[model samples]
Target: MLYGSTYPRDIFAELNRLQRELEQSFDIEPSIRGIGRGGFPALNVGSTPQSVELYAFAPGLDPAKIEVNLERGVLTIAGERTDQPGTPAQQATVHLNERFHGRFKRVVSLPDDVDPDGVSAVYQNGVLHISVRRQQAAQPRRIDVH
Candidate 1:
């Protein structure tokens, strides 16, 4: 231990704190795919001219238990993962447990022009995919003029 010296771990923790502060000051919503906040089921969001696509990467989860909803231009995904059998049992010596096992929820704001009734969700190969189609009037159209 030395005076006026900072440890590497402390420096990184401080940097993370500063980043969170800056995001709050700028009203920047943290993404569900970022670290430090422990957002479960890391997400990938993208959009096309026709629809908005979102993918949640969650392995070892039952597709029937996942819930997806869209209301008032907002999308919500929530579910729970049961604990595995490796828990501290009478003869089990657990060393490292890094997997997420619990209830998790994520919400995303959608564009105003999205059609609420045109949303669809499907879970396959441990990934949950949700698509929200844009309104008809919001899509670009070709116009001919003299």
Candidate 2:
């Protein structure tokens, strides 16, 4: 068989096509812990007796651009990630863009025991850590008996 015309001229494009086909064949499911579509910025949530701790892993972001909100026992983290700089006149072709880009938001439902006024958030080293202190009345306390 003749070869020149049938061969793929763009190696990167061919590889990307193959990768997409393989992923489709495997029937993979998107997950929050992985770099799947719609699951930008993986999250880890945990609770302790005194407070609830939530950590969001999102790099290459401006701290000022992030918006954190807590209302009615719901916590929301939202921000935008700008795409990497490109070649002049948009001539660059991205071979692979596994990292998420653009606007993303993640919501979490908190327990009723959490105090609305006792929440704090800090973003450092590409990790946003949020702590919500539990209500004092809801915390465990030793009761005296006669």
Candidate 3:
């Protein structure tokens, strides 16, 4: 539905339609993670009365090599994953390779109510955790009258 006709039978078209539906049902920002939309690294976004939290899963990467930036409410995570060396220097080839390496950059559009000044991120156990407080004026409050 997103990019192909119903009878076109293109794999990418089906994927696009499925991705759109999933995003709509899950309230997910588009192209948030995985190789289909882009490549490497993945993230999850959540919200609370006080803040919005982002958890990016990136393993086998140096924390120092990773970079996170926010501009105009869009977050960008970029970094590279280095491959491990072979034990004997010449015996590490053949069958299958599944893990991803090299550099990747992902951008996520954030909610307008997020307070950029309060954003913070930390990489731990292969997950980059970010917390951005919601704008104080946007939070709900209760009022009472006598």
Among the numbered candidates, top lDDT falls to 1
Ranking by TM-score: 1, 3, 2
Among all windows of 10 consecutive residues in model 3, the one with the lowest summed lDDT is: 87-96
| Cα lDDT, model 2, residue 13 | 48
Off by over 4 Å in 2: 1-38, 86-91, 138-146
- Could you tell me which 10 consecutive residues in candidate 2 have the lowest summed lDDT? 29-38
The true-versus-predicted C-alpha distance at residue 26 of model 3, in Å, is: 35
Candidate 2 on 4-49: residue-level lDDT in tens? 3444446654454454445445744322222233255778889998
Give a tens-digit lDDT track for model 3, residues 33-100: 44344235767879998898988888878999998888899988887776567732237543433355
Q: What would the TM-scores of all predictions be?
A: 0.66, 0.65, 0.66
Reference-based TM-score, model 3: 0.66
Ranking by lDDT: 1, 2, 3
